[model samples]
Target: MKTGLREKLKWLRKPDSTPATADNTRATEPDRPGWFIPQKAESLLATPLRRQLMKIIWQRTSVSAALFAELYQTPVARFAVLAQQLPASEYHHHAYPGGLLDHTLEVMAFAAKLRQRHLLPAGAAPEDQAREAEAWTAGILYAALLHDAGKLAIDMEVTTGENQLWYPWQGAPAGPYRLKYRKGREYALHPVAGCLLATRILPDSALNWLAQYPELMASFLYCISGQYERAGVPGEVVQEADRASVAQYMGASAGSVLDNPQPSLAKQILTALRELMHTRYRLNNPQSGSDGWLTADALWLVSKATADNVRAWLLQQGVTSVPDSNIRLFDEMQSLGLIIPTTEGKAIWTCDIQATGGWSPGRPLTLLRVSPERIWPDADGRPPVFDGRVSPLSSVPEQPQACGDAPAMSPVDPGTGTGGDLLSELTLSLFSGTDDHTAPQASMTPPSGSEEKHIAGDGLLTVVPAETESQPPPVTEVNPPVPASITPPVAACSGQNFTDWLREGLLTRKILINDRLARVHMVEGMLFLVSPEIFKLYVQSTTGSTGDEWMLAQKAFQKLGLHHRGVNNINIHTCQIRGPRRNSRVKGYLLTSPEQIFGESIPEDNPYLSVLEEGSGTAT
Candidate 1:
């Protein structure tokens, strides 16, 4: 083994270990952070050994449930049972004496918290707020308990002497070196292997169903396999639990597992996720003052896709059986609109199932072979047709017989869309006082087998009509920048936004997006959009002079943020006038529009743009 890994292993087994009892608190117990799910402490205590540990712990001192879970998992009985069967010392990490028991506790805690925050459900007292916590607790606990169950075949070692070599079994031999087990064989491959073992441990009824249905197992595997990744929620919980347990067993800090159990980690993850949610909110109704309907929709799609793909892959890989009740986790994400189908041409589906092999926590994966689908524009945008579709993409539909061929279509209520385009009217109703003129927005049609979907267009629904020449005599113009009267508020941007409008503008205008590049571009766009509100606020809050490259960026974002608070800040302007100190190597540009700038980019120009350059070399 490498010296670093060896040192790490040695560190994990250090002495001065704290007893695994719930009552003993770590002296450094601040607010235990990092995705904590509140579990039923009383319930956990009912499990035989855990129950005993709990009694032992409280007898000494009271501790938070989180702390109790951390300490309770330190007992030897849990992982030791599984480890006894594994002969290869190398696989020990997977079933290392107490690892499984420890991870299971942590996962349960985290899952419980998730359910509460997301309202995952707890039965009768339901609202969205209550449901998520239930789902999280159930899904995560199951995965945690069985995660490392397959590590029984691994070996263990306790070496001594200068040259560490020899075997534990009699025929295993002995030397000047006193080795407990052979080298080069460890718990490195336990997660994938454990998944296979899970099938056997589960009742045959459960096992047989999943065996026939790969998707069921895939969901479990996705959660377990991703335990090593740094960013995701599931992996973070598992890794932290594993670390906390090890830290108690050995006297050393198992920082690599959970690292610092700081509140900052929780805040950071929440902050990033919130930003993502905010950006989605603004994009859905740039000019519509709607709630986070669009953002909610997008998130739902992501969750669904993840769940579906995981289910599909697991079944394909032959991990078919799982608890029936637990199957609802996959279903809920779909119903809540957490996962979405791939946009047409957005991604290519690869037939290669081996791509996900050798899976581990924190490992990066490329979900190839996913079919792409085009983004559809909302009703308020363009294209009059909203109901059942029957036409080809390139062809425009004829006017509806009911509405007739009137170019002056009725104005839609400004902002009433919800998560599924549910409540757009409340936000965008301009003429509420006079109900007769307002027209209702059309509803979306379900997908038919073979429609050619299109990319969601930039939020420009239509060009406003110029005031007719024959209207009443013009009123005197106000010299001051502020408008004399505020127009009624329209459905416009909401939620704190972070999109980098400059990057998005560049990409959308300059890049020729095919299927493959679109999704990648969108993900990049999402990241940029959820980054910071500094850009939009900067532009709407100021004007030129100090304006230069940075100012132009700020100005562009004001539009993307959809600054429709009132009539005074109706539009956004962006221009690269001049930097105070200019270098020819760095050129600049500006943009101005009616909506807030959600995101932007400055990618290298394409060959087509290169051909449009005015000068051959210098300014000849």
Candidate 2:
């Protein structure tokens, strides 16, 4: 379908909609221009590759010029020049020598465009920005010029099966028989090698900085390797620009007809540019994970709800599909407030505090009065008065801890009972009669032993709704002076051994796979393996894994028992806790695979910490 600039702009204007068409097109085309472009590519093949590299470099601080020059060597350039001079066959897309050069130029052009957009004119040369722009231009240009540089050093031969070619870098024929060899065996490693070779030549060039910022370099190469998927928007632009340029030339030369409208191309260019902007912004202002940092939930409430209902209003506008996890938390000070409905409707909302201590079960909480100059205490001490909204309640019950026997706490299914509405019930819990209703209260503690790895231990301590009707006031004064020290089981593990580490890792985060093995991936610590038997048992008991395959595997593992067979060890490096996979040994053995478990650093936002007293008992 033909989409107009107005229609495309309409989607971009809405955050909830996310403009999938724009994003997808930006991700796929390489000839599209960008808001930032470092330099122009000398050739078509070079454009996509250069575009991809520029996208990557913009992710981090900055790139150096010395490092930029190193991406392409003379020999590689010579080869590309030769390739470009050759006549392309009907089946060969980029089979000529200069193909690499063509891609490199396009990437450079896109990057040049992007640089012009973000950086100021006064800082354009020799300075870091200039060097960054230059080096970025150079590196991408090099990646484009050399991605297929090895092709110049090889030859293609048509055979019975399919077209086969030989590559000098891989020492194998890139032909019909071996797709990997033809495409580039050690395909993932070529860009690295290319960068190294390019560096040797341009020792003082801008790209040498890439060695220091490897992720940026890697991200650039990865985009091309995925051909765009792995590459974020900036990277995608490189790809899109390269493709667009080639398609334009190819169609022009062949007199081939296109089924699409010309405006589609412009739409694609704009989308890629937007994505590039989004990616750079995210990299520049990453979510902070420091002490006194805002929790994701709290941040969401403050930013989205109270901040002029910007979030809800945006959501209603079909702009973004932000999940709850994207929310953040803050421990700063502000006027006391409660979340009450704006109207008599059952819907509840957060609002400023009109007075302290007036909470009712069914009645909706509401207060529109703004307290802009309210003083508040932060984690450190009295900072300044915060103009923002504070959480209605500082403490709320956390999700269930992973006690081996604790039944998974399942909220009513969204599809069932009033669409799983809990406004009335949750509101009652928040306000239950009180004079201190505006103050933050301690969250109900999870039962002790809820985090125990084995079920044989005493049953976990849990909070069932209090059966009695009478209760104390809900609110506690704001920033009530810091309390005396309280020992928490989780806190005690600061200097623990491997077993303790394993327990903590498993209990805190959801299970993840590493190298096909099942184990919990930690954010900043070593990966640990709970006994596979216990792991399996826990999964079955908690409904962590489902389906017939999982159920059948549970039965087999049950039968297998805890006895030491050939596979007793749960390699933390190889463990995986993903969904069902085929088992060659036993149809439903449910064994972990090597690819499933990639090491993940421990999460900064721990799920085990208690919310009641910032650093109270752990395993809440």
Predicted structure with the largest TM-score when compared to the true one: 1
Residue by residue across 33-149, what tens digits does model 1's lDDT show? 221111222323344333333343333223345433432233222332332223221211222223344344433433333222232222335543232332243334446555555
Q: Can you give the TM-score per candidate against the true fold? A: 0.24, 0.23
- Best candidate, lDDT-wise? 2
Q: Could you tally the backbone clashes for each prediction?
A: 105, 112
- lDDT string for model 2 (277-381, tens) is 222111111222111112212221222112212222222111121121111100001101212222332122333322122322222122222221211112232
Kindly give the stretch of ten consecutive residues in candidate 2 with the minimal lDDT sum. Answer: 326-335
Alpha-carbon RMSD, candidate 2: 27.2
Ten contiguous residues minimizing lDDT sum, candidate 1 = 483-492
> lDDT per model, in order?
0.27, 0.28
Cα deviation at 592, candidate 2, in Å, is: 45
